[model samples]
Target: MSWGIEIYEKGMPIKITGRSFIFDQIAVTQNGSKTYNNIPKGRSLAAYIVARNRGSYFTVKVENNKISWNSLRGSQSINGIIMVLIK
Candidate 1:
């Protein structure tokens, strides 16, 4: 049995869109031990942020197929767009 989910079939880019408030965090976990290729490492994942609140910062962490993100700011709701390239 395999719990792995293929985010991309041809190693294409996937775009994810969401909204977040200050101090809000998001976590995405792949349901298997298999890891995707071309996944950014550690804080470098922030580079995948296509659009976010100005003056705000994003914290990203990737371990295996799990990804966590924290939106940092004092007070504000922001729309976040992230593009992930999977191989």
Candidate 2:
């Protein structure tokens, strides 16, 4: 995961939002595999978890504003693409 203030979706090319985190020293892991390094976990505005499927490329964006991790059902997915936004 990269860090700064901008986050981009894989293959999308465009940043997700103005508050997206785009940094050079962030740690990103996929399917339990480390993908990036030194990810910031203490930023108040930073997203704690950003998960993207390697196969389908579906992305999950989780911010730190909320105090709960909502549940998502696998059946809710469309085209096997499931994107979860947690806050």
RMSD of each: 12.9, 9.5
Q: In model 2, what are the clashing residue pairs, if there are any?
A: 2-23, 3-22, 3-23, 4-22, 4-23, 5-20, 26-39, 27-39, 66-87
The TM-score that candidate 1 achieves is 0.37
Error of 2 at 29 (Å): 14
Positional deviation of 61 in candidate 2, in angstroms? Answer: 8.4
- Give the worst 10-residue stretch by lDDT in candidate 2: 78-87
Residue by residue across 4-87, what tens digits does model 2's lDDT show? Answer: 333355445344454543432222232221122334565443333345343333233333432222224333331222222211
TM-score of each: 0.37, 0.21
Q: Any runs in candidate 2 off by more than 4 Å, and if so which?
A: 1-7, 10-44, 52-65, 74-87
User: Taking the tens digit of each residue's C-alpha lDDT, what string does model 1 give over 9-75?
Assistant: 2366543333211221332222212234554454223224445546656555565555545555534
Q: Please state the error at residue 20 of candidate 2 in Å.
A: 8.4
